[model samples]
Target: MNAIAFTDVSRSYGNVLAVDGLNLTVETGRTVALLGPNGAGKSTSINMLLGLIRPSGGRIELFGRPPEQAVARGEVGAMLQDGELIPELTVRELVDFVRGLYPEPLDLDAILQMADLTDLAGRRAGKLSGGQSQRVRFALAVAGAPRLLVLDEPTAAMDVESRQRFWAAMRDYAAGGRTVLFATHYLEEADENSDRVIVVARGRVVADGTAAQIKAKAGGHAVRFTLDGQSAAGLDALPGVSAVEVTGGTATLRTADPDATVAALYRGTSLEIRDLRLAGADLEDAFLALTREP
Candidate 1:
C-alpha cells in the first residue's frame, strides 16, 4: 500500500488558497521531498498530512485510511517548523514526555544518539541553541518509532558532521520499510537524500520526478561563454537556444541542444573567449529557470 496519497487536494484560508490541486503518492521505504520557496504551501501540505489542518477540496489517504485515522494509530511522527518544547524540560525529559504519549516507543537512548542529543540530554530545552532545539524535536519525532516520519527542515540545526549522522539514521529508518516526507529550503539536501522530488510553487506542484528526470524536464544542456569587449550575438539568437542572459560581456544560454549551441557560439564572433565550458543541468538550474519571475 502507498504510505500516503493526495488526490487533487486543496486548502484555503478564507479567500486565500494556500495549496491547490496537489496530487502526490509516496510509497513505503522511500523518502519524498516537498520543495518550494516561501508561501508555496509546503508547510500547509505537511500540516494537513499531520491532521493539524483540513483540506478544503479533494481527498487524502494515509496507509489506506484518512489522515486522522492514521494519526490516531500513532504511526505518524512530525517535527514541525515551530514546536512548543517545554523550557524546563531537558532533552531526556522531553523525550520521555513524548514517549509517554505512545503505547510502544523506541528506546530513549537510541533516539538521543541518532539525533546527536545524547550529550545534551541534561540540557534544558530553552537553553539549547536553534540547532540544538531542532535536534530535540527530532528526538521527540523518533521517540515513538513512527512508521511515517514527517520532518520540516529537520536538519536546519546541527553542524555538517551531525547532519550526516542524522541522514544515516533516516536512511536506516526508510530501509526498514518506513516512509519519510521531508520539506526544507535546503535544495542540496532534497537533491541528495530523496528518492523522489516534488516541487511546489504558488501552492501547486510544477514538477515531480527523480533528480535526473526533473533536470531533463527543464531542458538539455547549454553552453556559456565569457566575452572580452564585444556583445554576444548569434549564440543567444540561435534557434535551439531556449533562454539567454547577458551581462558584463558574459552570456549564459539555455539551449535545447548543446552541440548546436556550441557550434553557433564561435561561428561569427572573435569575442576573445576567456573561458568556454559546457554547463551540466541540475535541479537548481531547473528550479531557477522554471520559477523565473514573469
Candidate 2:
C-alpha cells in the first residue's frame, strides 16, 4: 500500500490559498523530499497530513486510511518545525514519556542511540544545545517506531557535525523499510539523502523526479573556461549554447548538449581556453529554476 496519498487536496485561510489541488503519493519505504520556497504551503500540507488541520477540499490518506486514523493507530510520526521540549525534563525522561504514549514503542535505549542522545540522556532539556534539542525532537518522533516518519526542516539549527550525525541516524531509521518525507531548504540534503524530490511552488507541485531528472528538467549543463584575454564574440552561435555569461575574463556557457558545446568551445574557437570545466545543474540550480516567480 502507498504510505501517503494526497488527492486534489487544498487548504485556504479566508482569501489566501495555502495548498491548491495538491496531488501526490508516496510508496512505502521511499525516502521522499518535499521542497519549496516560503509561503509554498509545505507547512500547511504537513499540518493537514498530521490531522492538525482540515483541508478545504479533496482527500488525504495514509496507508489507505484517513490521516487521523493512521496517526491514532500509531502508524505515523512527525517532527514539526516548531515544538518545545519540556525544560524540566531530562532527555531520557522526555523520550521515555513520549514512547509510553504508543502501544508498541521502540526500546527507550534504542531511541536514544538512534537519535544520538545516549550520551545526553541525563542532561536536562533546557541545558542542552540547539542541536541537541533537535536530536531530542527526532528521538521523540521515532519513539513509536512508526511506519511513516515526517520531518520538517529536521536539521535546522544544527551545526555541520550535528547535521552529519542526524542524517546518519535518519538513514539508519529509513533502512528499516520505513517511509520518510521531509521538507527542507537544504537542497544538498535532498540531493544526497532522498530517493525522490517533489518541488512545490505557488501552492502546487512544479517539479517531481530524481535529483538528476529534476536538474535536467531545469534544462542544461554549464561549460566554463577562462578567456585568457580572448574576445567572447560569436560564442553564443555555438551549437547547443542557450545562454552565455562573461565576467572578468571567465566565460560560462549554458547548453542543453554539453558534448557538442565543449567540442565547439575547444575546436571551433581559436581563443585560448584555460581552466575548462563542465558540470551539470545542481539541485539548488534546479530548485531556483523551478520555483522562480511566474
Candidate 3:
C-alpha cells in the first residue's frame, strides 16, 4: 500500500487558497522531498497529512487508512517546525513521556543514541540549545518506531555539524524500510538525500522527479564567456540554445546541448571567447525555471 495518498486535495482560508487540487502518492520506503518557496502550500499539505487540518475538498489517506486513524495507531510520526518542549522535563524524560503514548515504542537508550542525544539526555528541555532541542524532537518522532516519518524543516536550527549528524541518523533510521517525507528549503539537502523531489509553486505541483531529471527539465549546461563585439541576438538563434543574455563584454547562454552550442560558438562567431566556462544546472536552477510565472 502507498504510505500516503492525496486525491484532489485542497485547503483554503477565507479568500486565499493554500493548497489547490493537490494529487500525490508516496510509496513505502522512499525518501521524498517536498520543496518550494515560502507560501507555496508545502506546510499546508503536510498539515493535512498530519490531520492537523481537514482538506476543504477531496480526500487524504495514510497507510490505506484515514490520517487520524493512522496517527492514532502509531503508524505515522511527525516533527513539525514549531512547538516548545515542556520546560520541566529533561531530554530523556521528554522522550520517555512521548514514547509511553505509543503501543510499541523503541528502546529509550537506542533512540537517544541514534539522535545523538546521549550526551544531552540529562539536560533540561528548556536549557538546551536550539540545535540540541531539535535533536530531542527527532528522538521523539522516532520513539514510536513509526513506519512513516514526516519532518518539516528538520534542520533549520542546526549548525553544520549538527545537520550532518541529523541526516546520518535519519539515513540509518530510513534504512529499515521506513518511508520518509521531509519539507526543506535547502536545495542541496534535497539533492543529496532524497530519492524523489516534488516541487510546488503557487499552490500547485510544478515539477516532480529525481534530482538529475529535475535538473534536466531546467535545460542543460550554462555556458558563460567574455566575448567582446558579439551580438547576443545571433547566438540566441543557435541550435540547442534556449536563451541568451549579453552584458557588455560577457555573454551567458542557456542551452539544451552544451557541446553543440560550444561548437557553434567556435565556428559561427568571430568574437574572442575567453574565460569560457560550462556548468550543469542544479536544483536551484530547476526550481527557478519551473516556478517562474508563465
Off by over 4 Å in 2: 219-222, 230-240, 255-274, 277-288, 292-294
The lDDT per prediction is: 0.81, 0.90, 0.89
Q: Any runs in candidate 3 off by more than 4 Å, and if so which? A: 220-285
State which candidate has the highest TM-score.
2
lDDT of 1: 0.81
lDDT of 1 by residue, 193-261 (tens): 898888888888888888556555566466777765676656567756887878777777887567666
lDDT tens digits by residue: candidate 2, 168-223 = 99999999999999998666788788999998987899989996666666655789
Model 3: clashing residue pairs? none
How does each model score on TM-score? 0.80, 0.89, 0.85
Q: RMSD of each candidate?
A: 4.2, 2.6, 3.5
The better-scoring model by lDDT among 2 and 3 is 2
- Angstrom error at residue 28, model 1: 1.4
Kindly provide the TM-score of model 2 when superposed on the true structure, using C-alpha atoms.
0.89
RMSD of 3: 3.5
Model 3 TM? 0.85
| Model 3 lDDT tens row, 1-294 | 799999999999999999999989999999999988889899999999999999999899999999999999999888999979998899999999999999999999999999998989998998988998899999999999999999998999999999999999998999999999999876678877899989888888888999666666767458999878756668888777888888888898988677788999989877678999987775566667888999
- The C-alpha local distance difference test score for the whole of candidate 3 amounts to 0.89
Query: Which segments of model 1 are wrong by more than 4 Å?
Result: 157-162, 219-285, 292-294
